[model samples]
Target: MPYFSICGVPNCPNFAHAVFVANYLSEKLPNFFYKKIEKIPREWAVFLDELNRENKWYTHESPVIWKELYQWGGTKYLIGGLSEFWEHVYCYYGLESLIPKYALDELALDNLRFFADKRRSEARKVKNVAILGAGQLNSAILIQDLLEIKTLRKGGVHLVFKLYDHHQNIDRSVFQHLNDTALHFNSTSFFGDFNLVELYSSAEDAMADSDIILNLDDYNPKDADFGKHMNRCTIRMKMLADHLLVAAKRDAKIIFAGSGPLCYMATALSKACSEMFPNIVVITADKGFPFVTAASEETGIEIHRISAPVVWGSIGVNCFVDIRNAFFKADVYRPYRCSLTAPKGSTLPLGVVSSELRLMGYKIKDAGVIERKVKNNTKKMEDLIGRASLFSKLRAIGLLLKLWYADEVGDEIISLGVRSNGSFHVPKGMFFSQPVKLSESRVWVPYSNYPLKEKQTKKRIKQCILHAKDVFGNLGIMYDPDDGFDEDWDDYSKYLGEIGEGEEEEMYE
Candidate 1:
């Protein structure tokens, strides 16, 4: 981190905020991230003081330029692994205890380099972070966290936010709380000389030169008149994206956090609908777990709902007695194509219900009536372990933060079910979530589960993307990847080289 700081790269603090947003919204916002910090690491404070003495860090481009020079074979030590660089630092700077110990043996060093790969956090200088739909409380909470809390990490960063929102009457109470707390803060972790929060009325104004953009708006997609809403929102999103593409700085990471549920549903639906005629027979949901055949053309598809009492089994809990009859059934359901409603759970289970049989043995379809049994099993698991709404959404947000910050943990690894970036085996704009080993854009598709260019996977991914494109494109948005007006295609060098001085003569010859 001190090395990155000295090199002029901006670093994000891994700050955790105390949630004072009241208990009413506690159901949506979990308590895990809310806990207060007990102690600040003493070593980090000493490091900060040492960093303050360096003039190279205060100036921006020099450190970055120096780094680029090093990467381009300027420094032999740094060109190798982190340990090699640190070994020299230990001798030269005498900061032996400050840095992680390097290996003495060649084989040991090689193994350590492979195990603790430091290349994961290699992105340079992200100073500007923007949030779309900045009016929302959740958005504000994220922003407020940046302003107020500062966690000690490798490279300390100064953040500037360009917030864009339709609702201008933003509740700035969060900032007030941060400001009040900033005075009481013992550690000099929050903010640098360059910190600023700028508000923008338009996307064009907001996106320019932003290193990271967090888009949080759903355009009221969960509303009753969502079809009309989608049309309006989609147009707005397209225009917004156009502005963003043109305005956002080169190599900017745009965390497109808009409507993940749609992607999840489309993927699930595609899976259920893959390769078959509509007949009541066998189908597979999980590994060798066969089920969900529709009895008729129109089968009632509902988000799986169970009475709250059935889940809790305790009379003391008020939520168990709510008049809504049943909780939001996101986890399970009858698999089929049906009307989508807001506040309901997921469509994956319904996708399972609607699809026809796969392979059938002697009366296997009759034996495949395990929908009720599966739901019961799932419910039991949930009861034992407990379940929460918006778990996927929250997880996605956490992932975005980790990626944005380029977080480095120890040997421990975490996996997330996220939308694929059209990398490796996954097709572009895959709506369904795939299990990926979490860390800066490192997507792993198991060769055993999915063979390279597996026909079924390819077909399903294609189907999902097409449906999303149709639905989202109707509202003037390209929901899936397309080559239309690609910014990457625009090359000024082409005009210079394509029609050169001798181009006409060469053509004639």
Candidate 2:
């Protein structure tokens, strides 16, 4: 018995002929058995090349046939292509014409139609991800991360990246590089049925039908003066809010990844689109860098071992890295142990371990030292490169996105700058970075399980609220302190007494 395998492009005439002949032979001869494999026309050449390499044969073209020699330990015997298969059948089994020319043509045409329809269906299922600052380093890094994600490589919903950047700032070379990478991935079948990476000259076109929008627009201020820098950021944020309001989909999740006042920008965006796009959630991803850095340094653990440390308040100077609820792998640090002994290879809360260390007379660096370290490192990188280092920030954004899309994070908390609905005793309608967990529906909500009872922590959060108000006032963005708060809500104004105006100024200085 000869077990035959036939493979070719679905739309090829020879494929139809081969399929017809195989079916006829199987029906007439009990000893004959065969299976047909359909490949897309674009992949036919690669498939043929792979087949040839594996079999040590030089055959090419559609409808390549081979037979399994069952008696010879299931070894494969090359039977060549459609014409060769016909000759083989004629020589061995005394069979000649099987499929008519009209039938072959009709079958091939039908295959072509089916293939076209399938491609159209797949295109419709592909999700569009729009990158507003397509040429920037951060955008490039983010795209690279997206391409390497293993879930996307496995067959599922495909992605079509729509890249848009200012005409003068757009880097065509970067786009070409990303396109070439995608093509290489396709050639190797790394990305199954992936779509194209398109560059859009118009923002509106780029944002159309987009499932996600990553705002990586470069707003790094070149001005040395504080007032001038504030003015530049204000203008850029206003322009971005306007563009997003007009172009972005009402349901789309807009991520603000630009280097500016992230909390303020997210607040402005949320406020601007609140009425028309009420479901629109603006996520500021800048706080991830500081949050991770502080956690790793405090725990004396590897960055990857640190799970989550919440960033409370604004993103930059006013932000406080709260490790109260953060956890790290206990196995990473053998010497450090909390008051209670935990099983090996378990996770431990960072705050508990830090407290144990302090009780044991081991000096732990204060929050001010950790904050200074982050700021100094950023400043040093800027001084050397003439621009702010984006690698840490890029990693932060990637981790945040991963957490956002993942099914669960267990007890780990993620720090995100989201508009406050009066959670954490902060003023209503203010954009503050708080300890948050992803809900069952994948929405980020304030993590209220661990009460923020630390008096010092509460006081700093109040100061942050004041600083945020100052920033909004300076930028001419309106915010109501009492908005969105319930009538029974306790007076948050009393918490501000602990943070003096001079102390707030000196903290940033």
Candidate 3:
């Protein structure tokens, strides 16, 4: 899910008003969530300095631009400056251009109330289910739900509750729960780990024996000493994905128990599985308050049920149970059409910062959230993984470039504008495509927001103006790849010469 942050000094008139609007908006928007942190007093800085555990100052201080942005972005449009901090959201996302005015209006307090009060229904058609992760709390609730679902099954849909996890200890306990539950019901439940062979068996069995796989993996990060829990989860998912591809025959619904922070483990695992087994469905639910349910439109995940924080304590627990019943009968589950947009004809190097940025963008656009992409790739999956990573980097770059050049360059001509990273949502307005190469080693492609033709025109115009200004003045800016201005203009000169000659009368004629 995309995260949004609102910031300012708590007592400041501008800050207080923004908070009021933020609180109201959080209450209003079905898709939007909020995390409010109280301001840290400047006087407390001395106290913080005294404690000095790695000088956590860096952690508490907001980014340099974010503070300035909070002042500029949110103030103009908010109610009594209450939403002043949100201006960053509008600017960063280019939201005015992307989000329809109607949609924004729908998020208003009155509009949300109308939608919330309407006759809402839960999904009830799902039968066969696979439950991943064998955590005691999650598994216990999952088993109970399956038992209830079994009573609904009169052979309409065969149910398979396939359980997966990385903890060997938890596996044993999960099996005991499954066995105990099996004695009471006629449903089939299976368990496995990261082992490819085992994963293949479990996934194949589920595809044949089940309809929906309820993944309840622990999204919590494990201690470094114990090993990265997320990495373990990804490894398990990769193995599970390979097995799912070989095992699932036709349409299968794969639902994930979303992590606390929308970990990419589930997204990556679901994405990989979807790529190979395009027929399967994937859905994820938020674990926070106003718990939203998203059944994959592409992977067949949709965000449903935006319950409040208090509801998360109990109702959220029951949401897993509710989903099983809803799964059997709901048509709300739609496959994600193009959320995980991969780079065309390019193999992204895994763990590379550039590629990761692209993957993040793709995932955000897909899920409609500002969640990070999972870092998992191997020698064999390098190409696909590269595409994922590069997509993420591109999205980040688009936002950065937009903000970096926003003031000096007007929006009409400036291509890159940087905004708050937290404000992005899904079904990316941006398109991903292959680059038009200019040389064997060098290729030129437009960023996410710019179309090819527009980019080409802008690039030429910008280059011409830049060179003209450079020749007129001694603007000796160093050429560096980091800044967009530092391009190999030799290519530009050649390109310009070709155009210039094309326009001139031919001497031979």
Candidate 4:
């Protein structure tokens, strides 16, 4: 009955960060393989074992034997200093599955220190971690971390993991590496701090009281159409909605996310979750901080934005490596178009996100939004939207703006909101992206009629709204554009409305 969760059918990076956190706990339990790479060739074990005994972490210098050991394994090493330290951690712990890539560095280590201090302040530390559909290299990396780790959390709850993989090979292979689990693996730092339990249950069973639900699967976008993807995503959401009513505890967070192309599935999921679980807050997260700009919105200010999932994943994975002032560290802005691989010279997985963040809130101007408030002004990035077909861009924006208002329940800020109450003379539910800044985080729209500064922005917003009918129709939903009420649509609907063909004669009579 412990709290456990999955965000979505996330890909490699998300899984990796989950594992990074799962096995990472303060030195209170048996964590022999914490930070160790598993499933290594037998050839290098003895060499690593002997070398590990002689190394100490305090030295800025790499051990003389580290290079020779690297050649013995024929590894493609990126950072030599980091490689040496991690190799030392692995050999000392008597564990495997680590590659040269996932090593510790100064900045990453500093981030860890900051994270530990933050976690230490929390009331509860250890919690249950469940990974759903984990079947990639990230899975392997995660099992290693969950099986053992070093971390400090607020409530002193060292995270334990319950991994779910349908494939026999994946489950069996990961299970085999956890042989030491029964006996409780040994590590100098975590000799007898706490106990970790291994849990295995059906996905539905684990949903009960889960603090998080990561919806990271069903990413197939049919015929390159997001509406098609939403069709599939909607089915899944319906199932989850039914299941969660009886299973999920109140306040559980469900993040509809994944890798691959920007599909409308997440958008649909957001809408579906809100409709299904009125009491639960649904969040959209990804391990990637995808780049999106409000510059073209014709707004007063344009600030570069990264969604929450990416920021969380980046810090989670970094703690697996080293540390830094993560509490105040807005991770380095690494732009990735799309892929599993990290940027060059970095072994951490690619930063990913659902891009569910399309609004610019007034709270952004508040302190702590920018990790340390280092910059005086927000930096602008070239609209990475890149030129795309009109329909594609429209669909993309829908996903970005999905649940924009709903997600800001507690932290409400002025944002682009839709016309729901007919305050704008637009159709009751027409797409209306207005200045929805909150008078306060809890306040909803329309404290005073805040108007748009530019006509072009309004036109652009109107077009996006008009196209929603198309997006809806693609998903087998119908809409009569005439029912829509916009300045342009009103004139056109009037032309097409109640008047018969060539009615000018009747009018003259």
Judged by TM-score, which candidate is best? 2
Residue range with the least summed lDDT across 10 consecutive positions in model 1: 310-319
lDDT of 2 by residue, 123-160 (tens): 55776888877666645557778766554434567677
Q: For residue 496, give model 2's deviation from the true position in Å.
A: 16
Q: Which sections of candidate 3 miss by over 4 Å?
A: 1-127, 138-140, 143-172, 186-204, 207-209, 225-231, 258-263, 270-509
Candidate 2's C-alpha lDDT? 0.66
Off by over 4 Å in 1: 1-126, 144-153, 169-192, 222-227, 258-395, 407-432, 437-509
**C-alpha RMSD by candidate, in order:** 24.1, 13.0, 29.1, 25.3
- Candidate 2, TM-score vs. the true structure? 0.59
Which residue segments of model 2 deviate by more than 4 Å? 1-119, 151-155, 167-195, 224-242, 274-305, 323-325, 328-365, 384-386, 407-412, 474-476, 482-509
Decoy 4 TM-score against native: 0.36
Ranking by TM-score: 2, 1, 4, 3
Clashes of each: 9, 0, 82, 56
User: What is each predicted model's overall lDDT from 0 to 1?
Assistant: 0.36, 0.66, 0.34, 0.36
Determine the backbone clash count of candidate 4.
56
TM-scores across all candidates? 0.36, 0.59, 0.29, 0.36
Q: Across residues 1-509, which tens digit of lDDT does each residue of candidate 4 receive?
A: 11112111112232233334325522433532222222113423453455445543222222222222222334322223434434544565443454233443332344446545764555345555444444322434433543333331223455544444344255676555443442343232265554443434466665665654544333545566655565666676567666666777645544333332212333343354444342221112211112122221222333343222111111110101000101111224455654445556766556544433222332233223342222212222223433211232223222332333233334332223222334433334332333333334323343224333223333444554445545654564334644545565556444443444334224324
Can you write out model 1's per-residue Cα lDDT over 33-148, one digit (the tens) per residue? Answer: 11111122444444444544542233212111112222332331121223343454456445443312232233334433532354333333337777766644355446555554
Winner of 3 and 4 under lDDT: 4
- For 116-204, candidate 3 gives per-residue lDDT tens digits of 34412112233555555544233444445444433335544333445544453445665665455444443233333111111212444
